[model samples]
Structure formats: C-alpha cells, structure tokens
Target: MRLIEKVWFNSHPAKYLLVPLLLPLSGLFWLLSTLRRLSFKVGLARSVKLTKPVIVVGNIGVGGNGKTPVVIYLVELSRSLGLTPGVISRGYGGQAPHYPYLVTAESTAVEAGDEPVLIQQRCQVAVAVGSDRIASAELLIAQGCDIIISDDGLQHYRLERDLELIVVDGQRLFGNGLLLPAGPLREGQWRLSTSDLVIYNGKKAKKNANQPLTMTLAATEVANVQSGQCIKLLDFIKLNPSVNAIAGIGAPQRFFDTLKTNKFNVKKQQSFVDHHSFTLADFSDFDDTIALIMTEKDAVKCQGFCQSHWWYLPVDATFSDVDRALLTDKIKALL
Candidate 1:
C-alpha cells in the first residue's frame, strides 16, 4: 500500500499521532471545498443542467466503496425503465488522444480508463470520458442517450445532478472521520445528510439519521480472457487446482476474500495500486504452468496483450427486493 493510503486507513495509535499534523491542511481543504460549493449556490460559479436528469454515484471518502457495480446496476435499471442511459467519468489514469472520447467494447483501458471501458463492455451502453463531466454528458446525449449517470461526481458541483447517491464502505465508514490530509473523507461527515440516498457497499449499519441500504458484489461467473468462454465459479475452482490471483483495484483484499469465499485454492496473490497499467513484463515471474486470475476491472486493461492463461471473474451488484423497489421508484419518479 502507498504511504498516504496506509496512514489514511490506519486505525491504531500511529494514525492518531500523525493526524494532528495534517489537521491544519485538512481544515484548509474544507474551507476551499466549502467556498467552491458556495460559489455554485450563490451563483458565483455556474452549474450546467442538461436536458436529461443526472444520477451521480459517488463516495465521501477516497478509495473504493464499490461504486462501479452500483453504476452498472443503475445502467441496467435505466434500460429496464425504457430510458436510454449513458455514463460519464473523469477518466482517471486515462490519457486519450482528445477529450470526450466515447468508449466501446473494443476500446483499450489506456484510452478510455478501466472503469468506463469495463462499464461499456458489460452494460453495452454509451460512455464518455473527460475531465469536464458536462462535456462528457453532452457527448453521450449526442449519441442519443436520454439520461446520464455520472460516475464518482458527487462533489462535482459544476454539473448539477438531480439525484445524489452516496456510497460508503461498510467496513470502514470514514476511517478516522477527519477531512482530507488527515482522514479518508473528501467531504465532512455532515455531507451525508444532504444525499438523497446512502448505500453501504458491505455490511450495513445504522448511521446518524440516514438508514442506509445494503449492496453486495456477488461473483456470477468466470470467463477466459483469450477464449471468451465462461464457467461456473465452482467448476472453475475444480478445474484450476492452484492459480495465482492478481488484482489492481482500490481494495485488493476484498477481491481476494471473495475468491477465498468461493473456495478457490489461491496458490499465490499479487496486489497493485488502483488503476495500475500492466504489461507482459510484470507477469514474467509467473510461468505458464499456473493460471493468473484477475478481476473484470483488471481484465479490461490486459485485453490488449493477449494472455492464454489469464482469466477474470465477473460479479454483479445485488440488493434486497425492498431496496430494489425503492431505487426503481426513485428513478421512475425522475422519468
């Protein structure tokens, strides 16, 4: 783990010792953030409202709170509602030839980011990547998308959103509950009160005034990266007695724990930083004898360099029927 990540997520005395030093910076960040939001609220800064309503799926803290799966589920729900939906992202770690790049199934992760390409590949919906969320949404609208889903843009005030959905990590709610440079929160804990919905990505618990809905990422199937053949999780585990698991996500332990839950004999494990670009050279230590398993997010980036033994397990976001109905009602109200 990176040094800052270690400090931010740390729960022991060491983190407490260092947090005091960062409190001043965190206070400054809060001030700037509040000022920026006030600028939009007071008309000092402009927030563009598109023709179609926007649903933003984001988190208050850094690191992954399983927002991607929720975004995918939202896309499916949008289609089921008979509304053509498109996605817009900040294109984190992606450097395309130009701005507002539309992602396709064949698009490389390096070109349009790992999450956008994965969403396009899985959801089969139009996705645009750019720093300017408004421009990206415009591109999606030009492609006939009637609604927009902004991935990880809750704090982005420039693009006005009708529905704000805040996702939180159930295991670690807000780490130390301090602001940036001191704790995991990008915004203060009070920000949760303003969200229309709060979804916990793991074990659910009552927090403050909001009764959070629960969402779980369930492994559905495993597919061969080169052959495109899929098999049941049990069948794949039975077939591969020993394989090395590789993950380049925000939380590698979560993916690893999922593999263990499915009874996979993980002979070895490798974890990379979130959105780490990969090449064949990185896998040189592993021979062709053992298979290399990865998450669907990592698989998108490695598709360019074909690997015969490389495989990725696909997962779906699952929620209770009550939560599903409530979410559906909320979206339908917008339409």
Candidate 2:
C-alpha cells in the first residue's frame, strides 16, 4: 500500500470519468488541507512552543527537493554561528518512528533511516526520529539543543515551526499543476506564496518567481570509505576516465551530469528511488568494481560494506549573494 502511494502519486494521469470523481475527491483533500492550515492560522490547532526555534525545510511536491542538503547547510551555518543545533526527521524509511529514537554514530542506516544517517555523518549533531515530529523536536530540546532544524515537515502542521523554508525543485515546478490524485501538489500551488522563504535549488526558478534563491554545484571530490582516501575530481578523472555510478536520490542525473561536466566519461548510471535503503545484495554482483561512486546521501546507507573500490562524492550548494544573505538573516532571527 505504501509502495502504491509512491507510484500513484508520481504518475496519476487524468481521464474524463475520473475527473468527476477526482474533482470532488481532490476538492475534499484540498478542503481538509485548507482547514488544517486554517486551524493553525486561526489557532484552532495550537502549535507547540519550545525554548528554541524550529526551522522547517521541506518541499510542497511529494518527492525530494534537496531537503537533506538544505538541512545540512542549515546545521553547518548554525554551528559556525555558535549555536547548538539538533535535527529531527520523520525517519521516512527507518524502523524506530514508533518511538522517539536518537540518531548516533552507532545507529545503522536501517534503524535510523538513510537520510538521518547521512545527516549524522555530515552534521555530527544530535538527531532523532519519530512519527510525532513535535515529540522528536522536544527530544532534541531535552538534549541541550537550542536550535532545531527539521529535515522535512512542511505539511506536518502538528509539529509547529518558527521559520518555514520551502525547497523547490526548479526543474519540476508544480508538475501538472493539480492536487493529489490529479497532480504532484500535496496542497494548492498558492502554498508557496505563504512560505517565509522560497528556495529554488535547481537550474532555474519559475516564471515571475522573484527574490529567488539559486544554487550551483560546488567542487566534486571522491572519498574512499574504507581507507579514508580522498581524491580530487581531477585525480578520479585521471585514474579512471570512465566508470559505473549509482545514485538513489531525488535527481540521480544531477550527479551524473556533474561528473560529466568535470570531464569524466561515465558509462552506466543506475538510479534508484529516493531515500533508498541500500542492501548488500544490491551490489553483490558488482563485486571488485573500484570505480563505483555515489553521493554522500547514498553512501551513508552503503558505508559498512563499502569496498576499497567504492567511493563517495562530496559536493556543496552554492547560493547567490542576495539569496545567501536572505537565508542567513531569516535563520538568525530564530534566536
């Protein structure tokens, strides 16, 4: 059933008879979403207040929109400013959402989920997962955390938030432009107008979408998981001009494209579903392959069994000057 949601949401084509049924059904879903939003807006459903500020980074579209990297960027920037930040996630594919569980160095990708493990590796901050996002936020607060950065809770109204940053996949803005069962939007497109900030992390922004935040891929380097060997983009290109790559992300092609821009000739690019929890069996047949490289998000789930040949590429998000100032200012206000 859960698997069906992923497929159905991604490719819900419209038909005439389905229109009558879907129109009303989408209307109902919209109404419920609207009522839920109104409830929070009007205080019918009170939002939780914490000693620290909660900054939520998420997308309106169902699938990923650079959520993890945005969260990582937030954490990194906050830490440089001397704030002790804690992270919270729904743990989309983990085993412990039934209870509030901490993400630690010892936590496996299976237990803590792939994204959380990646966050733990990148941020080294306190992390936890639970269905009750508010509870997960509170747990982080209890750990002496003063600032909370939620990975993806744009629609989780129950959790409450101080700052709302909507991450948009510029390439696929509001696909089909209809609500669920009709299109990709979880709510109406107008939802973006209300967000405190809109981040366009892709190649371009939507028409007339101003004050837009843009990003360019920074340097790319490969790090050997087992031996801790770090190689520059040039070195990897020099060593092996061509290699096989795998990416289980919202946009696998981005990584592949980045590799190509760096002058490497990639032969095969295997893309899996986002937040993919990799299993050893997935790579069983690809044994002795030294040139397999993937993003850090995918690498976390594949770390323990990562062979000397397997490497992870690290890249950073580069924002424009105006956008960077706006982002930093909004986040700083949380204090």
Candidate 3:
C-alpha cells in the first residue's frame, strides 16, 4: 500500500499527523462536491436525461471496491433478460484518438481504458469511452442499446440517472469515514442512504434493510495471457505450486488475497498503481520458469507483450439466490 493509502485504510501513525493536515482539504472537497450535486438537484445546473434508463454502478470511495465486476454482472443480467445493454466509461488513463470512441475487438487498453476494454472483451457488449459520459451514452444509444450502464460516475451529476448502485468494500468500509484527502471517500457515508442499492463486495456485515445485498467474486479458471488457453485453477496450481503474482488494480491486496485463498503458493506478489501501463521491462525480474499470475483487469493491459508462462485469473460476480431474485425483480421493473 502507498503511504497515503496506509494512512487512510491502515492504522499508520502518520494518520495522527496527516489526517489533521488533510482535513481542511477534505472539507474543501466536500464543499465543492456538495455544491456540484446540489446544483443539479436544485436545477441550477442542467442534467440531461437520455432516451434510455441509465444504471450507475459506482462507489463513494476512490479505490477499487469491485464496481467493474458489478457492472459486468449487470450487463450479463440484462442480456439474460433480453435487453441490449451498453457501457460508458470516463476512459481514465487512456488517450483516445477521438471523443466517444466505440470499443472494438482491436481496441487496446491504451486507446480505451482497461475496464471498458475488459468489459467489451468479456461481455461482447457495446462500450463507449470518453470524458463526456453524456456523449458516450449517446453513442451507445445510437448503437441501438436499450439500457446504459455507467462504469464509475457516481459524482457526474451532469448526466441524469434512473438508478444508482453504490458498491462498498465490506472489509474496509469507509476508512476513517472522512472525505477525500483525509480519507478515501468522494462523498460522505450518508450518500448510501440515498442510493437505490448498496452492494458489498466481500463478506457482508449483519444484513439490514439498508444493506440487503452482497456480491462475491468467484474465480474458477486461469487462461494463458498470450495464447488464450484455459485451464482449471486447481489443475494449474497443482502443476505450479509456487508462482509470481502481480496486480495493478485499485485494491491490489484483494487480488493477492484471492490468489492466497485459492491455495496458490505466491512466491513473489507485487502491487502496482491502479491502471498502470505495463511494459515488457516490468516483468524482467520475474522468474520465467515459475508461472506468473495476475488479475484479468491487469491481464487486459499486458496481452500485447505477454509471455507464454503469463496467466490471468478471471473472476465472476456471484450473488445468493434471494439477492439474485431481488435484483432481477428490481431490473425487471426498469423494463
């Protein structure tokens, strides 16, 4: 974890000094965010409502709280319901040639953001990437999509949404419970009350009306990053008991933990900043004989220069039967 992240999520002694120093900036962030949201709410700023309903799957905090997996799950659910769903992303860490670029099979993580490309590849759904989400949504709509899914735009009040789903990291639920700079949240915890649903990405706490849903990421297989050959996770683990693992996601530890849970003897686990652009040199030190494993999100970015021994674990979001029915019913209502 980075120093600031340690200060935010871990019990670092720096928190005693850093929190006080960053509290003023957090207050400023709260003020600006509150004003921006209120402007849309009070009609001071215009919020464009699209022809189709938009389901925003996002989180209040900044780090990876498993929002992308939830978005992917929703896309699959929409397909199961026979509704055409498209995804729109801000394309962070990407420099596209044009505005509202439509993701194609040839799309690279450099052209479109990693998450959008991952979604497009895994779900085979229309994905639009750009800073102007409204424009991106319009592009998706033009492609005959019946519904839209915003990847991580909880604070982008410019585009009006029909439903808001806030994902929370059940393990580190709102570290310090303070706003950005001082902590990890973009908005306060109270924002959860106003959201349509609160989905926990890990072992959920005592269930109540406020947090009725939980999601688990289930990993079943590992695929060769270069050849696209698939193998059962256990089969691969049995052959290679000790391996190297790396993750470039919002919460790298979560990916590491998942590997550990699956009984992979992780010899060397490395964590990189989220959406890190990987180069061939990044893995120069890793032993080639031992398999190198990574999260699918990081795998998407490494495919261009990946080695034969490199593999990626793909995880799917799973819910209990009751929660699945509840979610299905809620989505059906949207139709």
Clashes of each: 0, 0, 0
lDDT of 3 by residue, 19-112 (tens): 9999999999989998988888898999999999999988999868999999999999998999999999998888899998999989999999
Whole-model lDDT values for every prediction: 0.88, 0.78, 0.91
lDDT agreement of model 3 with the native: 0.91
Clashing pairs in 2: none
Clashing pairs in 1: none
lDDT ranking from best candidate downward: 3, 1, 2
> Which residues of candidate 2, in runs, are more than 4 Å off?
1-25, 206-211, 284-290
Write down the worst ten-residue block by lDDT for model 1. Answer: 203-212
Q: After superposition on all CA atoms, how large is the RMSD of candidate 2?
A: 3.3
Q: Which candidate leads the pack in lDDT?
A: 3
The 10 consecutive residues of candidate 3 with the worst lDDT sum are: 203-212
Taking every candidate in turn, the Cα RMSD to the unseen true structure, in Å, is: 1.5, 3.3, 1.1
TM-score of structure candidate 3: 0.98
Query: Against the true structure, what is each candidate's TM-score?
Result: 0.96, 0.88, 0.98
lDDT of candidate 1 at residue 307, scale 0 to 100:
86
